[model samples]
Target: MEVSTSKELQAFGETSIEKIIEELREECEIEKHLPGGGYLHMSDELPYLVIYRNEDEDIEKGMDRATVRLILSEASFLIIGNKDFEGYQRLMFCLSEAMSSKFKSFLIIEVFAGDPESRKFKIKGPAGKLSTTIKVLQEQLDDVDSGYRALQLGETEVQDTLQRQPEGKKPLLDLPQLKDSGCLLLGVEVPPVYRSKEGEDYPVFFRSFKDDFVVALHKTIFHFIRIQTSSGVKSYRALGQKHLQEKVKEIDRQLAEIETSYEFLWLVSPANIRHIKDTFFETNYEQVLNYHYRLLPFDPDVLKRRLYNLKLEDVDDPALSYIFREKREELDLQISMLSERGSDSFFYNSMMLFGKISNDLQREAETILKEVNEKEDQDFKSIMKAEDFKILANREFDYFREQDKNFSSKVHVREDVNILMVSRGELYLPSDYKLNANETHALIQHEIGTHVLTYYNGQQQPLKLLSIGLTDYDTLQEGLAVLSEYLVGGLTANRMRTLAGRVVAASARMHGADFQEIFRLLNKDYNFTPQRAFNITSRIMQGGGFTKDISYLKGLVQLKKHLEEGGELAPLLSGKFALEHMPIINELKERRVLTPVKLTPRYLKSEETRKKLGKIREGIPLSQLINA
Candidate 1:
């Protein structure tokens, strides 16, 4: 017999049974060479042709032993290939149409292993299209009740069979049913489609096809095309233009949600307190270069290249553009503000704090380096062989290396700068820094327990912005890190002093002291070494601002007050919790979920001076553990 031409098929109103079958045949042949072979192999096509030619073969030979058995076997391959949504829909329509016209009655049992509602195709209109085909078949067959019973039985069997499969292994088939007596289409939905929000539409389609020859037709069609239409091959690319458009809309919605949440938080957070507390810090001059280099390790050239590539400034959405511009402006304003302030502020104070912290850490590191120098340190110059300054420098290098595994001398740290810097992770020393067993526990509670725990937990959330860190999240993070230290019994007088020194330095920078002045004051008045004073002053003045310096004492004081008032800490650790994003927290709290409360600056009034004076007068130490 002459095969139908493509022209002839197209002429059949694009929906004629003969035309669809012919198109299916052509499509199947084309799909064969493309990876996993398609439905309608030569053997299956031959049987299909024979069955079409002699529909009376079943009546003549009986259902059990018929010449059409070869064709039925071949047809099974086509059904298997229809596992994909498009293939499944096409095959179901074809078979349902064929059965409705040819058979007196037929039964179909579609057994979806998972929830049918959850097994929807990502392709739009698939469920509806398939349901229409099933309705056409059901109306023609007039055996809806029998079809429903068969469907239930098939579903049960499929569930039972799937339960027996080994964990992680795919079940070969969901369920098996007798064709003609009861045809069954059984399979598990692909995980992506199963979990997708679009899945809500699937139950309606599943229910529509609940009985008789429409079910049988669904089974036959699925059996025939399963192999060709695997979900893996169809998921990412098979999406129609309409579906892609819908996805774009969905992405926009999510972005809107994030922005709205951010705005709401901004409105509710204690912005006034931060602005008022910002008045004291002074900038340091000598450490200014170091501070700038430390905060931003990447070279200007490299940063420019990345910024150009990111096109972050070119964002089209007005709201997002506004936010981007605002952030840049804020950073620039901060830099300008620090530069404009004279030497009276905490810039020098911060420099002093950095110098003290660095020197103190360096001293501890030197002790260890000396031991290494006395023993295995012969390969390299011994710590004893080096001058004190050289020993301190080496200690700094080693300490930075131990802290950041990804630290590279080439890209991250420049030899020209003569300093090692780390952008991420907490930095601490061992003596005034090294934790004893109890202190170690406190450090863990502070570092890993508070900071890292919140970080990882935030990562578990759906929003990338939350995980990336919010604008004012620093205040809460530091406060909580300090609180955890207090809870674990690690808060001490020395720690309080260190924190106070940070505040004093930060305040001095706000008053515009240069690095030399800050270093001298810290060394002469505060009893910090020259090196320690230099490091601290550099940290405060270098980044063109002293933002980080103020947080240490302020965060600790706030945490102390909170804990003293019996505030719960668990809400602060929630995945969705954010200090900057306070309105969302309020919303969550309103909904009866635990969430972090808004964090306000500790020194809104002459709060810093008050705390400092209180510490001096009490002689009981600045940091007071609430429990103690």
Candidate 2:
């Protein structure tokens, strides 16, 4: 609609040049979604522009989708696309005149696809000022491929570059009239690296090449801005989609809505764990008990349809887009798990959702089991009840709440919950559960200090996804929470063995071990008591073999790997995130898209706990944490 605060242009054509030129007087970001599928976008008033002619026949073949993605990603430069030669040339003349009038100089780069087998980028532009961009783009090409592609630099006259169109039709702009407009144009012929054999586009390779194209494009734009334009922006990453669009927020809200739609674990869990275990013990762990579950709150099919319809492509920011897409995929598996509850199909879905127990996970779990003898459980006297634990947990929750009024985490003692757990930022306690003296402080740190703390910290962030979680955050979060138990002088040899027993049970179940078989493996092989083994096996076998229990130890294994490589624990406390997502988190952090964490565990404040954490950082084995 409005190009400037005052000037309005309903359509894009040659006649609007003077009016558009008037709007370019002051600095402004321009955006127009045009007729015939063309779009004009600018991060801010800029001297350089990336142009794509939608009329190109090769564009319809999906060869330029990567280039298209690079354009739409909101790179710092002014970007304009058009569907016809006449209109495209006219729009360029307007841009050149307006940009030259404002900044006294301008750079324009037109991108088009080359032959499928070209295996090279050809830059056709003026020789003098274009060399820097040509050189940078050429250098980046080498980074994309091993050594097969080349960058070909060629010279072209200004009028010739602007006038050229597909199919050798005719020149659209007058050569003599436009030569002195003071804007340099570069026609960049990008080879379709993603083009497949049947001339169809290979969508997979497009992602591989998208980053390479974006990197080169941004560097070229950065150089153009630094050397040519009056723009004060510095980093290329600082360019492109600085503001989060409503579409992104809407998608985020919808994603959060669907995520909150069903409490997956709570629904899939058996309502009568204590009752079933009594029956299981009576049968001598021989029968495959039918576990009852909570009624489904929403239609799985309806929620899945809603999930698929929320298009991620509508999101502009690259960092948010990637994270949102990943969350969406994880939600699909989680929702599918609910539908597959109490069936054989559920285990496969569990594997997809929770991941298989790898050999390394198994070895680490087995190693922990061996290091911490099961007899340790009998040695420690259980001293604290669920009521005492709830009081301390509520105090911990209140401690954070005092710092931030928005910290709304609560603690509850419920008869329904089987043991200590945190769901939806609230600590839940099983009324009958008892804790030893050390277990009291450790469980407090584990449930409230870490889990509740991260929830509130994530809530402080504008992106609700952080508070909810990133994909596969359970492993990282659980590992970090388990570590909190150790940091607070609470992690016990028996506690560590409990985590190990989970991994063994999950592994057994995944390898076709039935409920009774897995129960026997934990009771007979791991030497866990009949009650403890039944509890572990029943927990894992809930919802037709939920394997999330494995995350407790598997996460610790990965956390140790992360710490051994010298990663810190503070940034992780900012919100719930997977260990592998540090780079994106760092990027979003640098971009100021995320808020600084509001809360960290109080465990880190203790002199002894800090000492143990320091030892963990120095590569001490996780099992050694018990002795620490």
Candidate 3:
């Protein structure tokens, strides 16, 4: 067949076995795999040739593998010269198409390859012949080097045009017309020949194709489009002409639609914002910034008006009204306290910020409630069944009892320490022991580390709220708690799963599922028992919303990653330690007076404990203690 058009030329160029093998070797290198059976090494400028041997014609009935190897031994060569830039692009495009074809062939052959004994190809003799054929084919592609050189020249012109664009300018390809072309690009596939594995299956059968390459290509194309659009915007600005107003507006509208679809702002309501600011500042700040950017496309006036008139009562259903009211009252009091103080204390500032957040949350809550009530199926109503309460109470009681005997003795010197288990509209606590391992950790970190540490730390400082808590204390508190778990080596798969399960159950409830339905779903879908599932789902449901449930897994994952990445836990822990309104722990560390900090009592007893509790010193840095 005669190759005519650019596409046809590209297709023909990639069809050569030499070109395919070279490309495959290059791809293997990119993925850090051994190239060319670890026999051949590649360099940017050096040319490598692949020779192909005809498998059927070369094989005689009595020929051994050594004879086949000798035939391939005569077929190796190195081609000289380089392809220009434009030619490289054309070659890559064509190669991409050829790879797609190869991928389809591999897909068809994969099932057969899965059963090695069923393979039609002979392995011992054919391996030598195949290697020889690849080498011979490499010698035949010397003519394409000039084509690559020509392609390079063309790419230079495109790059020059892009260089003239301004900073922060939208790219031309970002325009709706060009962006819409993404759908058309989906037809490309990854090639199978590029996807060879060492031990699993034969590479000849399971290679990657063009379709597999499509996803990666699409991303690159989109990135290129963005660059082009940004350049175009800069170029237009240089000419003092505005052409992207309508386009920008369209992009903004699309973004807004996405935000609304995902209920993006719902995450930043007063409670969440305050929780983030107070507990998890760094993480929450990023979330807040993201939400801020999403809202950036909108007019400030529009956002302000949206924030001002928003009310929980307007949207919350009767079922959710009580919960909303309780939260609102709590927020209002907090806000009121902050307003009266008018101080620069961290705690006061946090309260004020949270107050503003409360308003935003109330509005979103109302909207969600209204939506839930107006929807027809109301799948959530069934989840509120009475049976769920019994299951929750039973599980909470069992878990609490188990945890209490294990953790309480070390942490709480006083027998009066409570391990309260609130679930399914009821609070259950052993009259003697009132907290579980999770709750105990929370109190030690939040109450002792933050509240007590701050109170003691503040006595030395002139400020009072520094002892109270920062607006973003939740991040710090949660981070510290999770970190404490790590220090104590108490983080477990079951704990992680339970935390994740709470998020799932909350999402279910948000979609109109009730406690009972969520409980059953957890049991049925996730294989949790009736009682355990009910306990988890009910704990989340009872609080109007179960946002805290997400904190455990999120906190632990973040903490573990931080520690693994070499972040010190001692500084964070010491920054918030104290002994019953005594001296600040950090100050004590600086003075070399504070002993090593002890791991939480619950953590010491848990199966996941890293070191023995008896060996850990009180007030010492976690890193030093661990190393020591």
What lDDT tens digits, residue by residue, belong to model 3 across residues 1-628? 1111111122223344355446544542211111111121121111111111112223342222221221121111111112222333333233333333432210000000112121111111112323332222222112222233422211110111321112232221222322233211111111112223333323222112111222222232223223322222111101110111233233323322322332211222222222323332344212321111112233434443433333432321121222223333433333333222212242233333322223333333333222221112224433322233334344433443453332111121222212232211123333343334433444343334333333343323222223333223334445555455444444333433454565566556556675457767777776655545645754554323334444443444444445555554444443332111122323323322233433223333454444432233233222222233
Angstrom error of the Cα, residue 363, model 2: value is: 1.4
Q: Which residue pairs clash in candidate 2?
A: 74-240
True-vs-predicted CA distance for residue 609, candidate 1, Å: 29
List, residue by residue over 1-77, the lDDT tens digit for candidate 1.
12222321211132454545555445432112111122332221211211111112233332212111222212122
Q: What is the lDDT of candidate 2?
A: 0.72
**Residue runs of model 3 more than 4 Å from their true location after superposition:** 1-462, 574-628
Give candidate 2's total backbone clashes. 1
Error of 3 at 93 (Å): 74
Best by lDDT: 2
- Expressed as tens digits, the lDDT of each residue in 45-126 for candidate 2 is 5676776655444445533555666566653333333345466567667777666667767667666676666666666654
TM-score of 3: 0.27
lDDT of 1 at 545: 41
Query: Per-residue lDDT for 253 in model 1?
Result: 39
Q: How far is candidate 3 from the true structure (C-alpha RMSD, Å)?
A: 26.9
Give the 10-residue window scoring lowest on summed lDDT in candidate 1.
236-245
Task: Evaluate model 2: give its TM-score.
Answer: 0.80
True-structure lDDT of candidate 1:
0.35
